[model samples]
Target: MDKMEIVEKHKLLSEKIADADMVLVGVGEEFNEDFSDIGRFPHLMSALEEVDIDQMLEWTVPFLEHRFLIEHNDGRLVEAYRNLYEMVRNKNYFVITTCIDENIKKAAFDTERLVEPCGNHEMLQCSDKCCDELYPSGEFSDLVKQAILDGVGLDSLEIPKCPVCGKPLAYNNILCEQNYVEEGYQRQWKKYTKWLQLTLNKKICILELGVELNLPNIIRWPFEKVAFYNQKASFFRINASSYQMTEELSDKGISIGMNAVDYLREYQHL
Candidate 1:
């Protein structure tokens, strides 16, 4: 797209996104990798090579694994996580993140995943019974489906079957791990999905922040489709590479090759 066209579409996108009833935010590790103090921890990586979920679930693991990454003068890791969490929690937004580490999940939920040191403090309580009251998040479900699509076996996915009923296990609707079984959590997640679906059919703007083609199509495809269908539904994508939009979507979608944080500042007039 031309510079003039890009700027015009960006203005439209800003207006639409600002007025959107619901915005689906997909949390990614790119921002963390760029901003995290830790490059890599050799010892922690070696320790995690054992592939023991139980051992990894120890209370000390999250702190130890993320110790290097979280080191920053302004507590950047924690603050960024909290800021993103609060943004989604306060706005009509739903977050979809990959399960790369326990610390990321904890930061996303603002709650501990391990039950060893702080058993009762875990966000989701367990029933220890076989109940069909659990649901999984679209993000989590899409991850599993994508893994399988990428040639991962069901067993290799690290999901365990139901212990009591011997049935297939599902991530409590968020598709994190097999052990993610919480009815309450699933209920809330479903609400987000339902809201997103409803909003997609309406005229809305999508702020595709820092998302790239390397990411999954779960969010991108739908956003593109919406922009294509509705002339008023503008789209904005901020990346390092020069932004490009589909020929059909170019009129409504804006592609900006710039940092997302910088764009956000400008967009918000901060």
Candidate 2:
């Protein structure tokens, strides 16, 4: 959708949801991969061991997991999470995050006590020809400050060492990898589940933005059901290509085809 339309939609949605007591906003993964403003980084190709690069593209988790690992290790994940947390907290919105590593979420919350499980060995192992650029970790400022105290130039400063093992560090933000492990991730996930279940019955508007039906079961099916029984509820799916509303959903839901950010911006102006 164009900017104007998006803003208008968001304003309407926000107003519509204002009285609903609780609004469950499910943040999708990497909404637009091609958007450079979002930034791209190296991802570990775990499937390279068993399948070709062409075949690996069919599997979403491995590719995304790799990118998440790189982004988290570099501190981008922390910044994004902080931004999201602040936004939600300011609005007094009871936010729940799904499909994100628990430890990464914790680090984002704690801020000062950031830690990564894998050392540089994992990074070197995952580095491939296609993956060259490093995700900018916002933590670089702190590293630079430390380097200045030691009287070193930016170019001569070494990469930050891992606090856990005192070894060289790499981004440990990959999600859904077989080897991708995080402490306390499950605990946060359980909390999210509890919150979702507890908030299910109230009047809600399922604002499904840029989501596709064929993508993953975690998003599609549950949302479909949520929009089913909630009599005062509505489901709005905004997408460029896949735009359709079931007979039942159409009776109570509103589906649009457009860019989500543009819609939100338009609504803000309205």
User: Could you tell me every candidate's TM-score relative to the true structure?
Assistant: 0.49, 0.51
lDDT of 1 by residue, 24-74 (tens): 554332343342433354444433443355453343333333333333324
**Tens-digit lDDT string for candidate 2 (1-270):** 455665565566656666565555543433323323224331223323223534433433333343444344424334444443442332323333333343235333432222222211133211221232233344543443453346443334454544444443334334324433343234445555665566566666665655554444555567777788777676667656565777778776666676443433333322
List ranges where model 1 is wrong by over 4 Å.
Answer: 1-14, 32-36, 39-63, 66-91, 99-189, 261-270
Please provide the root mean square deviation of candidate 1 (C-alpha atoms, Å).
Answer: 11.4
- How big is the positional error of residue 112 in model 2, measured in Å on the Cα after superposition? 17
lDDT measured at residue 93 in model 1 versus the true structure, 0 to 100:
54
Candidate with maximal lDDT: 1
